[model samples]
Target: MALNEDLQLQALRLLQADPARSQRDLAKALGISVGRTNYCLRALLDRGWIKIQNFRNSRNKRAYLYLLTPQGIDAKARIAARFLQRKEAEYAALQAEIARLRAEVKADAET
Candidate 1:
């Protein structure tokens, strides 16, 4: 997956997990710049996948919460399924390669 796609997926998961998380905090968790985080958020919002709500916290009254819309949840599911499928394929390939290597080593040792 590309950076934008990965960023979107991580942002969706984190926002779904914790709506009240700050953008700066999300950026830290995502290892991306705040500007990039904002860009992702804007894209999600534009797609109507996520919504922002105002919440008053002890320290910040203007804190904005990122909540996933129903559409966002559905999208997240699809993304997760695709990611799992790709990983499974990669794992199978790795296993096959390992087996091949082990057999080659055994044959060499026998000779």
Candidate 2:
């Protein structure tokens, strides 16, 4: 996945886990700047994947709740599946490299 897609996936997962998290908190968790977080959020919003609602009774009047739409839920699932597949492929490659190195080391020891 591209960097933006990766960030979006992380953001969506984080929001699903805790929709009440602020953008600053999200940025911290994502290890990104708040401006980038805001950009990702705007993209999600434009895609109709999430909706922002203000919490009227909250102490922070500017606080918002980010809720995922049904489409967003489905999108997250698909993205997760793809991410898992990519990780699995990487794992397989690493395992192959490890096995090759071990065999090479054993052959060298015999000589």
Candidate 3:
């Protein structure tokens, strides 16, 4: 599956917060299937945005750590800025719409 920018940003944030989290946990938090999470992770790895290391001390041999590279950190910042801009614009539009609706309601009440 194609990894969208939103998913990429969220995954990066989650992994950065706790690199030792399992893929299943990540997928659960992300509300996506494990397979899709795996795909997204592979894409991130291929892009050099993230690096994976096995956790030797963990009892679960399959346990791994996902680390964000410098590039990934920079990418996450950019993505977060863009996401904030979009949300701000959407909020402004919604605010305007609410004002318009309130005005209509007031006018109807006055009539």
lDDT (tens digit, per residue) of candidate 1 on 33-72? 8988888898899888999988865467778989999999
Lowest lDDT sum, 10 consecutive residues, model 2, at 1-10
Between which residue pairs do clashes occur in model 2? none
Looking at candidate 3, what is the lDDT of residue 60? Answer: 84
Q: After superposition, how far is residue 12 of candidate 2 from its true place, in Å?
A: 0.6
Error of 1 at 4 (Å): 3.4
Which candidate, 1 or 3, would have the higher TM-score against the true structure?
Answer: 3
TM-scores, one per candidate:
0.88, 0.94, 0.96
Rank all candidate structures by their TM-score, best first, as comma-separated numbers: 3, 2, 1
Clashes of each: 0, 0, 0
Model 3 regions more than 4 Å off: none
Q: lDDT per residue, candidate 3, 19-79, as tens digits?
A: 9999999999999999999999999999999999999888889999999999999999999
**Candidate with the greatest lDDT versus the true structure:** 3
- lDDT by residue for model 2 over 60-106, one digit each (tens)? 99999999999999988888888889999999999999999999999
